[model samples]
Target: MKRRHFLISGAAGAALSMARPSWAMAGAPAYLTAASKEGNSTWLVGLTEQGDVVFELPIPSRGHAAAAHPFRAEAVAFARRPGRFAVVLDCATGKEIARLDSPEGRHFYGHGAFTADGKLLLTTENAYDVPDGRLGIWDAEDGYNRIGELPSGGIGPHEMIRLADGSFAVANGGMQTHPDYDRAVLNIPSMKPNLTYLDAQGLIVDQVEPPADMRLNSIRHIAADDTGRVVIALQWQGNPLTAVPLMASHRRGEALAFFDHPETVRLKQYAGSIAISSDGAEIAVTGPKGGHVLFFDGATGAPINGRALPEASGVAQFGDRFAITLAGGLLEGGASGGKMLDVAGGYSWDNHLVSIRRV
Candidate 1:
């Protein structure tokens, strides 16, 4: 298979044999995201692959990340960090089916994933007092109850994904915070961010840390393609004026490779979200702080294009184009440039948008 490479537009020419995405094979794509308002009210919205809003369910409070079930129309909307609850909604009916509470002395980390079989929901959490990162396991079929927890391998673990081989790739952000300081980072000078691989049984099998110079570049969000190759987005805790690699790549056992940008000074020090192109050959990293969705070649990790999007952060792929959620609506961007989809509604989209997919 001949793979076409573009810096920001990766999935342009890669064939199915090359991308090998099971969800793409199944057809009819959809996505889920948590949107909110200033009044503290929130919602979990679902959208068709064409960027049309399909369903919306009111949530109890603010939300950050969400996980959609692979085989069913169900989603778990997690409250932003320091929050203690997650609501499981039946997307087919827009009804709240269950509410997951953080165990005492712990708080939800606002991101989670379901196993390949959809039996357990794994959430990142910060253990109270002790202040270490933990993955809370919820039995999806058993009323979404807290069953147990596993070590996150680092502090302040943020986003995680289930890989094709059934192992989990977790981005342990490593910046400890307590509700005490209103989410103020406490370990910027010594934060040890790492990409950790956890097996089905929740055991850490491998780990890769960032280079010494970029230690403050926190690995915050992550996405994996068909081959289990992961691209990580980071939030820099160092001086904002110093241009640094806000993205990197890692395989299970290899050293994490930080990417260099041609316009380092122009790259936002913070990446709110990241998405790998269907062919796994391109990457889109959104920087709402800088108001642009920067695209890169997945293979070479070089800058290809940077499209200006006001408050552009949320991003996901439907088929050929990337769907980004901003206050204006869902914007579709590709080789031809960016345009808004005709999706309508009162959605105040958040920092991240997720494509519904198979693990």
Candidate 2:
């Protein structure tokens, strides 16, 4: 501890400064997440840059991902997929300020993103009865009200990212399922997974689809670098023994390039999470089923390296490298080398992790 204590002090000061006007002092945003302990207690947690826990608040149910407000030290914790509830909390005070509920026939897909201006919140929703994907809009300036929604361009929208040009990219997993069926995929013979780019108003700008033979590859998770290049992770819905690419990168006006790692065959065709390094030069991904973390070159489909982390699922930027979260703890490598860190608090980590920059 000496290092922990020092970083804790700095983080405390940062938290205090966040309460003041941004011109007076700007406190960097802490990493926020939802973690569970033995499936009993689920919490939304904040941590400093050095992996120190700053605050933890018990959520009513399991949370899959969270999005931090750009200006205020606030966060919104999303419930797991097929969920109907999400909680908005004040990170500084650890209080629940609001709750977002799905409309009568729709449910959340457990992920969301905020615009740079922080004026609106966007979420992926599924109209189970009508069987379509939607982008739920909320009025941030007006108390998180459900303002309206727009079409998400395809079915089973899982994750999305805002681009540098004020647009959105969605990963349409292309599988149809209803909560009543308990995660049983309803469509397989004609599953049409696609990566769609939408304008800020939610109009389809463009879309990319895999070839005829790769339809079983579902686009589930996504990450983008500072330069607006997007990388997507795939989960194979085909046979267990068949091997396929688990990752792909997309650039505007260019075809999607599948990362062809001769060793990707070992991933078992499942990647739970995806994240880019701080410098935008490397992409990191993790697989819970295969118990491994792999890195790919940002510009090429070449595999840089790989590491093993049993039950590893979450991948996020950690300083110069990326961190992997598992039941045992958090690993700070998966790039150069793997080093264990103590941030799990003896809890089982969920599938995705993200870094937040306050101010």
Return the lDDT, model 1, position 245.
80
Error of model 2, residue 151, in angstroms? 0.1
In the range 207-284, model 2's lDDT, one tens digit per residue, is 999888788999999987767788999999999788788999888888788886655766788889998877666788
Clashing pairs in 2: 29-358
| Candidate 2: regions farther than 4 A off | 1-29
Task: Kindly list the per-residue Cα lDDT of model 1 for residues 1-359, writing each as its tens digit.
Answer: 11111111112222422332344454443777888756657888777767766677787777888887765566788888888889887665557888888988889888998876666788999985797999887766556766677889999989988898777888999899988777899888789988899876677889888889888989999988888889988898988878788878887667888886664445478888888877656688888787777788877888787777777768887565588877667787753476787667756777888776533
Per-candidate TM-scores read 0.88, 0.89
* lDDT scores in order: 0.77, 0.77
RMSD of each candidate?
Answer: 9.0, 8.4
Compare the candidates by TM-score and give the number of the best one.
2
